[model samples]
Target: MPQTDLSPISAAPGAAVLHDVLIIGGGLVGASLAIALDRLGLEVGLVEATAPGALPAVFDERNLSFAEATVNALTALGVMQKLRAPTGAIERIHVSRAGDFGRSVLEAAKYGRSEFGRIVVARDFGEALEARLAELARLRRYRPMRFLGLADGGSDTRAVRVADVDGERVLHTRLLVAADGTRSGVREALGIGVDEHDYAQTLFVTRLRSERAPDGTAYERFGADGPTALLPRGDRSFGLVHGVARAEADAVAALDEAAFLARVQTAFGWRVGRFLGCGPRSAYALTRVLAQALTAPRAVLVGNAAQTIHPIGAQGFNLGLRDALTLAELIENARRETNGAGFDCGDTAVLAQYAARRREDRGRTVAFSDGLARFTANELPLLRPLRSLGLFAADRLPSAQAYLVGAAMGYRGDVPALCRGGTQPGALA
Candidate 1:
């Protein structure tokens, strides 16, 4: 995390921007990847369509959950300490079904951890990423630019066609990374098809002010409409994500604050007390997008561009950060091999290694998120009793609680070095 003087724009106007690696997107994942590479003294270029700080979609507004492991990784990478916003800790999790007979509680202490995770607004996180990106002297940023085309593939040196403020430009690099969000242009240019599933659900997000303050606790209540989550925020307000059918989203959004609070109270009960006030509401259609492959020759995908899953487990962004960290570690080593002779950061070996190592983690996270979304929303009576039994078991049984707690904390199989409280290629930094 040591700072260095940023390398000047290595690529000239109307000429190829030459670098060790070129990132096609500069969102959270993409920007962090650039910073991680800069820490290793790699010449990196970030191509972003939007100017810094003014991001759209999930980049702002909503309160986001950062798995304990994810926060540790970002902190180790010098990304978290720079954030300016206040954050809350999730010391415990309460899970139950509306009007169900049983409930489950997962405590961080049960797993020998101080807290399960931390919560912060997307706006604050966006600001942190920008701050880090600005300090990366090794990174050359190309903003207000886009991936206009892909050229020089199937060649020794691959070049990406980009359109930016300098007009038509070309970026030649050993690798092209597609951190370009779900509608990824690089993914499309690579002809990489994605398996997408529309959950037919829309999530309404807002800040809730309850009469009784949350005590470092988070709740997930599953009802007929969908799953509702009340996450503890730093300001003592609860961040709420209420899922409803697509057809009902508009009607729900049109409801006034009082009516909306009433609906939430009815679904969640008095567990968290009365909903007093709430901020403006926003809604998002839920869908899962997984690319058929994680990498292609001279190109790779990371973050949301690789997989966009249901937000139930808070795994989407956490998993994406892993993708970035994992890729950075692999690339850092690749640069040292051969004593830097004809070193290729985009070598097939690196891509293959990344794809192999990420396969299990990606599969597990996607399955966990998708399964939670489907099962909790299923209205079948036969599943109700089973769900109740499962929740109660998690609450009562140590092994059951451990399993859920481990996953939520990002402590699953083959955890990345940073997540494990260790560093990979640490000597380089």
Candidate 2:
């Protein structure tokens, strides 16, 4: 990988420049796709609405728990190696209910692995992505550019209108990718409908320094109100995500540092000891968004654009990363099949294959995240015994533990080659 400058964004309306793929959204997934396709020798274009050298708004102080598969894929793409800060390894996980009689503990060593995944700050991760994107030699990046709308479709390509420094420009591409956020403009333009659900809960995220430093163990505690999570951070501070009812969000946010720390310590026992100090906190309303269709004519959706699930299981980014890698692998495979004779990246058959391959993964991840959230949030007394029984089973039964560990490690159906340990992008058949 090598550095390059931004290409000219203004082109003649009639003489639309054709591309193998035009990805609209230079965030995590889009940038990762550009890097993957760059390896396959394709004319790729990346559209970033944000100003040049500025990180996307999606990157913030929030912390992300990366699954093993996501780690492998990012490492293969050379993005993880450019991380500016150290990451915290998740070697163990503990799950419990505040007043439950039983709990479950998953250890990576039990499954013959050193660690299941790592914890990274969203802001730092975005910096690493920026570093990797700057190193691409052939990526035609259009910064401070806006995706106006979609033009008429062609037999084998799609026309897109975008505006930049000069003016409006028409660009043609064999494939169009919508890696935008939950409220995606491209997906809407493609006539795709989104199914949404409001959880009525607000999650507050921040960093807390406890008496004892994090030792690679992630704790998730469920209560009647919501769930509290303590994730290990690289700087010996714990990343805390405390979920409260939407009605109480304001009061919770307004709490003083000492009061907030006391409430968190009460909800999440004294497992790690007293919380001495904290940092600035942010709040987000939890919502689930799922696209009705993954593909349309000469176009496809990826990342948060395709589906946004609850963050209870920490499955959002990991699932989206898998989507990006799988699509890239399919495109590379199609190109290899044609022996570089130039095949349409947006071929109907190829898009159909991508949808089919992603079916099992998307469904399972959505269900896992949504189900866990709803199950833990139910305050019915009748379900308490059942929840305890389930926890007990997960703790004592090897089969149950295996299933939980597998899902946590992102070993679902039809995994991409790049997600496999030690496998590179071009390893696809």
Candidate 3:
């Protein structure tokens, strides 16, 4: 992928930069929004706390599961074509609960698709997004910048104060977007609170070398401890996200490679063969963070800022990408209605429309992830039989299987223009 050093700029303190949209936290989602808006004739500015050659810790060694729809959206945005590294396709998913007699399998071929989705390492995806963002003609990139707070910009404009390497300046815009993660500053500054849930579990993740090359299959094994997922990655290895009791996480991390591999093998069984070796591991306490509202006065949240769910089903980023594309479409269509003259980028009516359309999709996604995570963790003996029966029915019944496959492939919920492969108004002319 092509890499560009952020065009150097030194805006003086208190000097104003006018824009139609100002996006805070220029990670993948923020950058994607900037790219979308810039193409739609909006002057955009991205404020990032990290410097150019380095990114926030969330973009560290991690694998991101991209739904088929997200891949289509990336392709439409011309970002997928710029990737230097290839992705691993998830052609099939095998799911089962530990100590259960039944298991379920979802195959992409049954749905007339070659793959359910693809997996890309966090670093690779970020590189592609950053490269694409650099190519934006109407985007002003600001790095090593800290958002001070929202300032009173009077009517007709939203003002954000930010400090960069040079000095502090106020960014004026008609619309403000927060793509920042869980503890979003923009969300907090706007006084938008979140309803939080702790799963009481922690996830230990790393890349693993297997005795045999992965055959385009991903495994989700639920156990007494928690769910363990192995996503196929390149180099004949699998990306492991092993969930364990929060209290036991440190001990697991302290295990020697031999012992660590043995524990995982014992929990997951020897389906895909033994895990030979693994790279360095990291752990995070699992939690679900959801903002009370999706929009504020002249401001709104996207990506994790809007909702953060457990990673059990890999719905986090995929849903966020949908948020980005939906907002873009709403803006594109609204602009056309006004003949490019009287469109208010952050009008209450426009924000309300975006929020109203998002309710069902966001609600269902979070509910599904939370429900699955909790259900798999349930260890009651009586419920085990029922859960097993459900799994078996889902596997054998075509209708049940189709519903499961639809959710897994992200064909459920609202479909966006980018995912449909239709020409977008924001596509470069």
Candidate 4:
């Protein structure tokens, strides 16, 4: 890693010296944003707290369900090709409650599609993203860079102070993007408030070798205790997510491999067959966090910075990816017009537009995930029957099925040019 020290310049005096965008964080969403912006020929600088190549492929058994639409976005960005490994295509999803008669089965065949999405290991996905990032010549990466604080933004320039492992430095840019995790330093320095609610639960994740093949089917079983999901993997292994109360998380994590496997098998049932072997288990606190606002004067928040939802439906990362793509589209369009002349990248007008573009999608996703969490955790007899009926309707209704397919595919509103597989036109002068 390299170190650079630069004096902080007054926002007004240094208005002309800033890059087009300076993103503070280099996780998946941040890196993706840099790639998208760089493709549009924008000058982008990504500051990361970790050193380059310091990213690890933690063997913690976790995977992501990349919807067809997400796959298309990554494929267009030249990321999918790098992930040249066998993926588990989810042709059908079965949702049911233990001791309940009604269940919902959503099949891709109903929509004339072979699969709703494909599952890829977290490490493989991260590797592919890293490979594409390395090939992007236009994106400047500053690793081992720690964000110090935010300097005030002027009419043209936004000043961000950062430091490396050695000393302090300052970076000037027109737009500031915060893609750090839920506890984002950029968001905090910008005075962005987050509404966080602890779900009083934790998620236990692990990989299991099963006696029977998953057959490309994913299952979500809701019990009085919590929701458990079984997602297929490439090597005939299954990724399991078991939600437990907050008080029980430590106990679950402390369980030996055999004890943990037994609890998992009992919770998930024998639909996929006997759980043969188990890997180490990891636990994460489950909470719902949302930014009071997605964007401030000249700054915007992406990924977990904007919203951190419960992992009930695996919506957190997918939502972040959408945020990255949406902002890129907006910024790319702004760069093309004469009106964009002297436009402050961190201007409230632009930030507001970005926020508006994202509100509906974010709101809907939050509602969906929160509602599912509530429903699965409820034990009311009347609510149980109602939930069963709703599931039956969702399984039987063609229109409902189509809606689910579209939602899962990530095509909610007006599609972005990049998502439509078209080149983003240059921004206005």
Give me the candidate number with maximum lDDT. Answer: 2
* RMSD of model 3 against the true structure: 2.1
Task: Identify the runs in model 1 with alpha carbons over 4 angstroms from their true place.
Answer: 1-11, 424-429
Residue pairs whose backbone atoms clash in candidate 2: none
Q: Which tens-of-lDDT digit does each residue in 1-429 have in candidate 4? A: 222222223223334446788988877788788778766666678887766666633312477877776777778788878986667888888888876668888888877889877888777777787888888666767777789897765667778887765566578887889998888888899898989888888888777788897788888898776789988777778778888888888888888888888898888898987888877777778888899988876789999889989877667777788899888888766655536566456656668888889888898889888888888788888887788887788789888777766777667665466665666344343
Tell me the deviation in Å of residue 105 in model 4.
Answer: 1.0
Better of 2 and 3 by TM-score: 2
Residue-level lDDT of model 1, residues 175-219, one tens digit each, is: 889999998989999899999999989999989999889798989
Q: How many residue pairs clash in each candidate?
A: 1, 0, 0, 6
The reply for model 2, stretches above 4 Å from the true place, is: 1-5, 11-15, 427-429
**N/CA/C clash count, model 3:** 0
Model 1 clashing residue pairs (backbone):
6-137
Candidate 2 residue lDDT tens string, 65-137: 9989889888988889999898999999999998778899999999999899999999999999888888878
* Model 2 alpha-carbon miss at residue 108, Å: 0.5
Candidate 3 per-residue lDDT over residues 314-424, each given as its tens digit: 889888888888888888888877867867788888789889878877998899899988888988888799889989998999999887887777766776778767564
Pick out the ten consecutive residues of candidate 2 with the lowest summed lDDT.
3-12
Residue range with the least summed lDDT across 10 consecutive positions in model 4: 2-11
What TM-score would candidate 2 get against the native? 0.96
- Between candidates 1 and 3, the TM-score winner: 3
3 against 4, candidate with superior lDDT: 3
